[model samples]
Target: MTQATHRPASWSVVATVRASAPVCNLFARHYLARGARQVFLFHDDASVACNVALHGVRNTVCQGRWWRRGRPDALEDRQVHNATKAKAWCETDWLLHCDVDELIWSAQDVGEVLGLIPDDVGGIVINTAEAVYAAPPSQHTMFRTPFFKFFFDERGRPRAYRAISQQAYGDLWNASKYGLWGHILGKSFIRAKADVGRMPLHHKKQERINGFLMRQQAPQLVLRHYDTLSPEMWKEKHLRRIRSEVSVPMAGRFRERQQALIAEAEARDGNAGLDQLYLRMSTLPPGILAECLTEGFVRVIRPEAHLLAQDHS
Candidate 1:
């Protein structure tokens, strides 16, 4: 058995989460174990169970405190509000804003990696390795998936992911700005108290924002994003998206594309049709998964080894 190496630094993480108690606890545990100074989880839905579950965790802050007058209507608005407030409250050298489903993966301690960044660097972009499954696993077991793909982009273009997605979906696929199903531009760790105009849905990118400088991409760290794990989860997710009135800003055709897919699936065979579409898009076939692994389109990662002291534990 191997133990995580700790290089201590003042760094904290913040997220606006709505998840089960166990899920919330795991998020706190993983980051705390990975050497974050503290983990602030602002409950979007204010689940009492989740707050209670985190009680025993040292350096974990669980709260349902609304940022200001009341909760915002849009989910993205709530996220940005929570992240901004957490930044003000955090007494750390750096603060990371990411989702609960996204875990920081690094061979060296996270703080040690951040320590090397120069004072002039305002933030650092952590590249993402989106999780890919061979088969749909239960949501509880999704994080343990051994396969992940790091989409290669040349000058902000996802040529590699586009090629692979085209092979999978054929005529069904369309050219997307991002490589992955999730946010193509990964999350970031900003210097605490850095002057920023506003927080975007993800992070401020040089291409998208002016005067927001980011350091060269960190080599040792990658965000392991479990975008969708099971067909049931996928179905529930898209159904909510379709029904919701508040949509993401500048989302391009992504929202429209999802709504269309769900509608088509329902017309075909209701839930079963939706499940089939999800399976096809979310998980790779055995042959393609194997080929992607061999051809360097994707790579295998065992984060459990670092998080739990055992692979797939």
Candidate 2:
């Protein structure tokens, strides 16, 4: 663990990537537009050549493992190393370690919300929400709409809730034993000067680092994880993860779920059955999103108020 000796003025976004160019570029654009000084992106060598080639902002790039190597933990370890390496190259006072789809939004400017974080704090533990769209975003997506954001108490403890379609699917599509798939809770922001080692997917190990972990009492900074935001994007993402193993710790269990899904698909009519499964997973959610809101799954929040896609209504 290393303690940061200096704090700079600008902030940066450090991301470990395995996503497409457009997705990666979009991620970089979102942060840069929000005042990120630089983006430190890490990807495998296969993508190294063209990575960050599309970003129009100040940015840096690093490389992760090119092979699927050992357990999913090994890949996570590699990503942690990449994040650490990116931090070394970063000159900013604070950096956000996030993924392409996970947009960290704030009603106030992100930097301003980040300012609420104390100088002595190591980082803030933020909660995540799987923003389910009424349909594909037509205009301003994230900024224009209120989502099924995570419910966090004043102390930052998460209130997990299943989606509206919770009863639509069986155990295969159910939330994992570990936690709800989209309502994940974890760290999003970290102090640059802290002596820390990256661990557990989105967060790093802060034991040796100085200061206590602070929680943002207000919903100023909520991570909008767009795992199912668009049909094409969702299909591509889940298909890739289904065809290959992911670095998430619960991947083995996930794989079992996938296998069960595959068995059911085959039982029904092979590829057609899988197609049926995908259709159900994607299509049934809009009704549920509405029902949940009406029935009060997560109350419509202020600033974080409701705004569905215009065309959907």
Candidate 3:
């Protein structure tokens, strides 16, 4: 239960991860190197195979108890549990809840971000943007084509519909509840010192919930999402998500576009069936791609675009 004494000036990132995937480890390494003081890895599955392969790093692994059937009411119960544990182990004032797939980038260092945050400010709201990509050409390791990018508006709202963009700020309370997406919302923030048991703001959400968090505006930071890393992963994850149910209402259009993409991919590389699916999904609406390139968040060098254009031509 030892905690580090060093607390930086700005916000401290509090990341909660399952720690089973290689991507999670890569995320930890990248953020730790970039000045993240503490990272909490909540091990939901206590089986021997579930623990991450991180060695000699500042992290706490909490082996979560098994749930025997009924749906758990709290979505981010694990995060709340881990955060409480972190608070007891290491006393800290601020927490930044983020996921492995999301990254916070800034021109200034971590300290600078923290410095901008005022002590009176209970929490800060950040925005997320989806990074899309087309399929890679033959023998290439990564996707090469540029697609349109989505942006979040000033009030921490996502322009495109994405559940992860909405978040909250507060300390542990008794009645706090986690939503379907594993985020806690609709709770009173405790202004004074209070014990965990006595706090009424515990996490508790009765029904499925999603959307934005209300808070003061702050400097812009990108929450780059790599949800669609590949076409195969895209189809698998998207189809499996709760949002997939929405597509059923729009089934005809979905099927038509899906078939056309499949045809295009097969035309390009039959063996690359997965790649074809990815290209179609990642293709941004015509003008959006150019807008993102002009903004410089996307790397659309002239030669690469020229080669892609030639191939299409």
Candidate 4:
């Protein structure tokens, strides 16, 4: 019998976080369990608790005060700086830049996925699937669900957008042009040792040192973004933007919609307005979820919670 031979590739992940300790710990643990060689976490805040939570996790590095001269004004600028720093120091074959709320959902080992790509490809563009609430969520709910809205790359076929338009899903369809509340460009895995252009927010359309385009979009591995899993999360995220605590880009329809939502949220007292907007746009009723699944507008990706638990055990 001929034994199956798997090509060897080492990959790492990096994220700049300003979240709770548990959230930081889970983000590191999940990728480690998913076969990441190393996980680099740059805490945007000087939180001792978040750093301490990751201290014991094997093959993970947590850093604070990563900025040398001074911190950048925009959150995305900070992320790009940290990611570039990680790429310089990472010894792995590839380094991925992602957010703390995002997780890579892969059916196979991440390294194996990269190993299949041609050597000439300098970067890989992973698409995203935004998480959606299958049923009404409670106050404490946080990404504890299996439903996701997977929008395909419209570079070729416009099938995904056509399907969403056919739904006439009101606020849901009109939430963003790509039918996602978050970025449709997703995250990226840049070749660690390869000389490439400056890392942008999305990290797609990367050019090589020779000024040649070398970005390859791989739709197989999906970046599962838990942008807003519950009403509390939704409210707090928008509030941060409203208060100027977080920096969102000035351009794009997404930003315009976000500004409108922030204004609406501030107009109403308490969490009522945010809660209403969340229900109308983010959450999915049971019947609607089923119908979406049946029509192939949404997909059920039940990532294993035990994957991270096993590492902790």
What are the models' TM-scores?
Answer: 0.83, 0.71, 0.53, 0.85
- Model 1 C-alpha lDDT per residue in residues 19-94, reported as the tens digit of each score: 6675667788788777787688877664333662343233223333444466567778877777777778778888
By TM-score, highest first, what's the ranking? Answer: 4, 1, 2, 3
lDDT of 4: 0.69
Q: Local error of candidate 4 at 150, Å?
A: 1.7
lDDT string for model 4 (1-313, tens) is 1222347578888887776665666777788778787788877766433563443233223343445567677787878887887888788888889988898988877778887766766678787888787655643345566878766733434346556534635644555655567777778888888778555567655355454335676766889998775666667667777778878653367756765765776587446766667776677666767777776667788867743242331
Off by over 4 Å in 1: 1-8, 47-49, 52-67, 153-158, 175-179, 197-200, 206-212, 245-247, 306-313
RMSD of each: 5.4, 6.1, 12.4, 4.4
lDDT of 2 at 90: 74
Candidate 3 structure quality by residue, lDDT tens digits, 1-313: 1222343442344455543454455555545555555555555434422334444234544443334343234435555555555444433344455655555554557555554543443434444444455433331212233332444333434332222212211111111111011121212221111232221222212211122122434454444445455454444434433334222232233344444554555667774775544554444434544544554333332222222322220
What is the alpha-carbon lDDT of model 3 when measured against the actual structure?
0.40
Model 3 spans with C-alpha error above 4 angstroms = 1-11, 18-21, 46-90, 134-148, 153-214, 239-275, 283-288, 295-313
Q: Report the C-alpha displacement of residue 273, candidate 4, in angstroms.
A: 2.0
lDDT of each: 0.69, 0.54, 0.40, 0.69
Q: Lowest summed-lDDT stretch of 10 residues in model 4?
A: 55-64
Q: State candidate 3's TM-score.
A: 0.53
List model 2 lDDT by residue over 136-167, tens digit each: 54223533445553444345544434443354
Deviating ranges (above 4 Å) for candidate 2 = 1-9, 45-49, 53-73, 136-146, 149-173, 176-180, 204-208, 212-218, 229-236, 239-259, 266-271, 283-287, 298-313
Return the lDDT, model 2, position 216: 29
Between candidates 2 and 3, name the one with more favorable lDDT. 2
